[model samples]
Target: MKIKLGLLYGGKSAEHEVSLLTARAVSQAINFDKYEVYPIFITKVGEWIKGNPLMGPVDTVESLKISKETIRPNSITSFLPIDGDDASHLDVIFPLLHGPNGEDGTVQGLLEVMNLPYVGNGVLASAAGMDKVVMKQLFNEAGLAQVPYVHFIRNEWKNSQTALLQKMEGNLKWPLFVKPANLGSSVGITKVANREELLTAVEVAFKYDRKIIVEQGIVARELEMSVLGNDEPRCSIAGEVLPTKDFYDYEAKYEDGTTNYAIPAEVSPELLEKMKDAAIRAFKVLDCSGLVRADFFVTDDEEVIINEVNTLPGFTPISMYPKLWMESGLAYSDLIEELIALAMERFEEKQ
Candidate 1:
């Protein structure tokens, strides 16, 4: 029998629009002959509605916004079959989601409880990856070189404002990037050059997440590598993100489309190997499965400082992860197939 693959997207996240774009790309690329594809959309209001199997690739995003006539607020019963109803039995799920409610282990936990096989990292890795502080701690333990950063919760920041500012000023350099600990897509990240900007940035970051992380900004090239598989993940060719903006913020990532990319970035053989090793080490350290986009900051000296790993990276056809893999000789459709196989393999291993 053909595998029943459910594509989950449109999450209640800052990256919801990107998730929708990814779903559209995956629907177009998926091999309809080998598997039956279904759409499981999580609306902005947090309702889960599953759509029927696609006869062929969806041509438009509007066509994919399927709503169950009977679906109620926050209910997912429409997705669960009644008393062994085979129609609702999904062989696997490919979650094309990014950021908080989707990639931060909440959806993964739901799948775990339902005993459904889903793509990408498990609850632990998802949760850890979403929280920058936890992810950095794990990276440190893995002996990965990282930029200096200080993290604290909203309460701590509010209670010890003066002291925290003093600590950051003393330790970090002039330009620091303040970010929400549990968000992606460069949302709620601000580059502060002085104490006045720092205060405003911290306040802005707290709007998205209770905890915030401030990293010492480094003048280095932004490089990224994609790792695929479970247990033994392999690294893809490194890609560089050359942002023309002040920094790689939300607009540079998705909106403006001005950021120039150097696929198979100009790297010496030794530096490439070092980055690959660091990427693999990060993948293993996070205990991540399926796929992860390991981002890095490479200095002029070729020092590879591990940045962070996106458990479920941006996956549109033009996104960095798929593009990097494509450059490495894996077509988009083949990458999707491999991810499904990896998902099933991970599920079977757990069983």
Candidate 2:
């Protein structure tokens, strides 16, 4: 019998559109003969809608967004995969979601509670990886070299705005990159070269998350590597992100078509080795499963800095994660198949 695979996409987070795109890509690439594909979309307003298993691969994103009229919004009853919810039962789930509610362990927790095997990082890894400050702390524990930075919550920033500003200015260098502690896809990241920009950036970041991180900007090359598997995860060859803009922000990453990627980045053998080691170390430190996109910064002097690890990194055909793997000789469809197997393996181990 064909395995039942549910494609969980469309979330309440800012990366909702990216999720839709990913669902479309996965559907187009999925082996229909091996697994029956189902669509479970979470609308922008947080509606849980389930569509029937596709007779073939999805041709457009609009088909994937069609909701079953019987299913109510925000209803968990349909997702439990129990007796009452017959059609929702599945062998595995591929959560093609990025950022916040979907990628930050909230959805993972739900899957765990329902005893369903879902692809990607578990609760601990997802939660830790979602929060920049927490991920940095884990990197520190793993002996990872990272840039200097500071973090604060909305309340702290409000109560001691002056002190926080002073601390940030004193501790970090100029041209800082401020980011929402618990968001991804560069949703609320801002590059500030001065005090005025810093204040504005903080307010903007707070709009997405309660906490914010301000890292000292560095003059270094942006490199990324893909990590796959569970206990014995491995890293792919490094890829470079070349942004036409001042920095790689939300627009450059997914919109505006201003970002260019260099697959199999030009790195010395020694530097590549260092990056591979660092990426695997970050993966193991967070106890990540399935896959992770480990992004880094290599300075002019070849100094490697751990920027951050994306627990559920972009999985589109053009996304760095899959592109890096493809350069390493893994086809897109095979990569997805491997991730699903790894998910089942992790779930069995948990049981």
Candidate 3:
């Protein structure tokens, strides 16, 4: 019998469009003969719509746009198995969501309560990874070297704006990067070189989340490596993000053709070894499962600094996660299969 797999995508987050694209890409890459694929789409306005099992691979994104009649916004009773509501049971779930709400452990908690197996990080890992401040703390505990950063909640910033500004200015250097602490895909991120810009950037970041993070910017090459498996996770070869734009923001990462990537980046053996050590350390420290994308900054002096770990990184055809794995001799289809297997393995282990 073919295993039942649910492609959970299109969440109530800023990365909704990216989730849609990932759903389509996974549908195309999934081995239809081995798994009965179903679509569990969460609408932009927070509707959970379960689509029928895909007969075969899809070619367009529109086909994966699963929708249904209104059933109240933010209500998951339509498909979610809660309050004894019988959801279409699946062997496992592949959540292709990013950013807040879905990728930040809220959805993972739901899955855990339902006793369902879903691909990627568990609650603690997802929650911590989504919050920049928390992730940095965990990294520090793991003896990981990271750039200097400061974080604050909304009320703290409001009550002590002057003190917070002074704290940031005194602790961090110029050319700071302000971001929403619990968001991804560069949704609410700003690079500021002065106080005026810093004030504006904080307000901008507040538009997305209650917490904010300000990191001291560095002139280093952006490198990323993919980690897979559970207890014995391994790291793939590193990939370099060569963005022509000033910063690797949303527009530069997904919008136009301003960004270029170098697969299997040219790194010395020592550098690669250092990155592998850091990536695996980041993965193990968070107790991550299924997969993770460990992004880093390598200075000219070959210093490897842990930037962050994307619990559920992008799986698009051009996403750095899968691209690095592919360059390491794992095909896209095989990579998806490995992730599914990892999910099942983790689920069974917990039993």
Candidate 4:
């Protein structure tokens, strides 16, 4: 029998539009002969809706607003209980969400409580991977190479600019990146050149999240590797992203579409091997399952520093995650099948 797969996407995240793109790509890639796909879309207002209208080509934001159905929280149409008599009701849930409420363990926690099988990492790993500050701390504790960073609460910056500036200057240097700790897709991120820009950047970042993180910006090549499976995960050939700006900002990533990626990135074989090794280590360290896209930065000196891991990386036809795997010899349909098998395996293990 074909498995009933609930594909969850879109959420109250800065990356909501990107999530829609991912959902559309995933829904199209899955083999219909092996599984039945259910598209569950969440709106920007945090409404979990169901229906065929939610799935879209998603070339623009205006299209999603018109196509999506709004679902109320805890409504029978919104959430499904795992204890129902029909065990075949929903074989698994594949979350193609990005940023805060979607990829940051909030949705994973709900799945765990509901006893539902879902793809990707569990609560702890999802939460750890979402918070830049916390993820960096865990990486540091694991002896992983990463850029130095400092975190600040919103109130600290709001109430006392004098002390906050003093602490940041003392701990970090100029050319720092101020970011909302819980956001992704390069949203609410600013690369400050000096002290004056730092204050404004902090204020802007705080508007998006309660906590903010400032990291010493690294001038290095951006590399990414896609990992698959659990326990002993496998890494794909490394890929390099050539951003169309000073950095991979929001505009460069999605809007301009000028960004180009080189699969099997032009790097020394030794350096490539090291990056793959580091990527797998970081994935296992975080107890991640299913699939994760690990990003890294290779310095001029050949040192590899992990950037961050995306538990639910983008899934658009042009997305790097699927592209990397395709270059590594896995077809899009095969990749989807593997993820489903892994999710079912993880569920069985937990049961």
Candidate 5:
């Protein structure tokens, strides 16, 4: 019997548009013969909408323009199990969401309460992976190499910017990256060269999230590797990103199509092996299941520093996660199948 898969995408997050794009890609690649797909789109206003228009192309912004006829806006819908009983339907949920509310364990928690099986990590893993501060702590505890940084709550920043600035300056120097702790796809991120830009950067970051992270900027090459499966996870061939801007900012990641990626990045076999090992280690440390894309920074000294791990990585055709897997000998269709199977396996294990 074909599995009934609910492809969940879009959400109350800054990366909502990106999530839509990812859903579109996954919808196109999934094998129809093996699984029946249900497109579940979550609007930016936190409403779940059911429709076909949600799984369209990302190039045309018009496809994303919600129409009254295409979707039942502000309505709650239900999914049934593939078999067994009429009330029990959907076999599993495949979340294609990116940042914050979608990828930060909130959705996972909802799924847990609903007794639904979903792809990727659970609540604890998702929450830890989404928060830069928390992820860094976990990485440190795991003996992983990561950049030094500091974090503060919104109340702390609001109480005394001077004190916060002093604390940041003492721990990290200029050219620091100020980012919202719970955001991804480089949203609300600013690279402050000095004190002149630091204050503005903090203000901009606080607008997106209550927790903010300030990390010491590392002048290094940006690289990413994909990890698939659970327990004994496998790593994909390394890929390098050449951002159009000074850093991979919001525009460089999504808006600006000028940024380029080098699949199977030209690095020595030794370095590649090291990075792949680190990626697997990072994935296992977070208790991630299904798939994940571990991002790293290769410094001038050739030291690999774990930047972050994306539990629900981007799925656009141009996304590095899928591209890396393709380069590692897995086609787009096969990758989707593998993820679905992994999700089912994880569900059965939990039961």
Candidate 6:
């Protein structure tokens, strides 16, 4: 029997649009012969609707929107088989979602409860990877070097405004990056050069999440490596993010086509090995499975400071994660197949 793979995308997240794009890309690349592909879309309001098994590679994003009828409802029932459809392959859910309920452990936990297999990290890793402060603390325990940062809940920020400002000013340098504790795709991130901008950035971040993290900005090259596998994850060739804009914000990542990338970044063999080591350390430390995009900040002297990992990094044809793997000799379709195989491997191990 062919594998029943559900392409789970879209969420009540700021990264919803990106998720849609990922779904489109995956639909285009997936093989129709080996797997029974299904579209499981979660609308912006958090309604889950599952589409019929795909017949072939999709052409347009609009074609993948699905639903000429009213939304069946966003509950689990929407994804379940009705009376006649007995052999539907929700066998594995390939969650191509980003941020919050999608990237965080919420969706993973739901899958766990249903006793179903899905792609990417498990509940513990997903929860930790989604929260910047908690992820940093775990990185620290692994003895990974990182730029200085301070984090606090919304209540703490509201109550200790003066003291918090004092603390930030004393500890962190100018040109700070403020971000929501639980978001991705740079959804609620701001680059601030002074106190006024920092204040405004704080308010902007709080709009997306109750907890926020502020990091002292570093002048370093942004490089990333893709790690694949479950118990023994392997790192891909390094990819560099050269943002012409102020920073690689959401716009530079998706909308604007200006961000330049150095696939298989020109790092010395020793530096690449070091980065690979750090990446695996991070993957193992988080107990991540399926895949993770381990991002880093490399200094001029080639010091590899682990930044963070995306539990479900963007899988679009052009996204850094899959692109890095492609550069490492894994084609996009093959990468998807590998991820499905890894998902099955992880599920079978759990049983």
Tell me the tens digit of each residue's lDDT in model 5 across 1-351: 877777887888777787777776776677777776766767878767544423332454345444332333322235434334543367788888888777889888877766788888889889999988888888887788988898999898878878878888998967899999987888889999999898889889999889999999998999999999987899889999998678987788777786888998988888898898888888878888888889999987779999999988888877898899888889988988888888778888888
Score every model by TM-score.
Answer: 0.97, 0.97, 0.95, 0.91, 0.90, 0.95
lDDT accuracy of residue 70 in candidate 2: 41
Report the C-alpha lDDT of model 1 over 1-351, residue by residue, as the tens digit: 888989988978777787888898998999888999988887887777877888998888888788775354346554554536687888888988888777899889878877889999999899999899999999999999999998899999979999999889999997999999988889899999999999999999999889999999999999999999999899999999999978898898878988999998998999999999999888888899999999999999999999899999989988899999999999999999999999999999999
Winning candidate number (lDDT): 2
| lDDT tens digits, residue span 62-94, model 3 | 887877544443454454554554346677999
Clash counts for the predictions, in order: 0, 0, 0, 0, 6, 1
Question: Which residue pairs clash in candidate 3?
Answer: none
lDDT per residue as tens, model 4, 1-351: 877788787788777777777766675667777777666768778777665522323345444443455667565424554435353257688888888877889988888876778888889889999998888888887788998788878777768878878887887877999999987789999999999898889889988889999998999999999999987799999999998688899989889988988987988889988998888888978889988899999999999999999988887768899999999999987888888889889989988
Of the two candidates 3 and 4, the one with more favorable TM-score, higher being better, is: 3
Better of 4 and 5 by TM-score: 4
lDDT of 4: 0.82
The all-Cα superposition gives candidate 6 an RMSD in Å to the true structure of 1.8
Report how far residue 323 has shifted in candidate 3, in Å: 0.6
Cand. 2 Cα-lDDT: 0.90
Which stretches in model 6 have alpha-carbon errors above 4 Å?
A: 68-74, 78-85
Residue runs of model 1 more than 4 Å from their true location after superposition: 70-78
Candidate 6, residues 1-351: lDDT per residue as tens digits? 877888888878777777888888887888888888888777778777777888888777766676633343334554454434555437889998888888889989988876778888999999999999999999999999999998888999989999999999999998999999988888889999999999999999999889999999999999999999988889899999999988999888888987999998999999999999999999999899989999999999999998899999988888899999888999999999888889888999889
lDDT of 5 at 284: 77
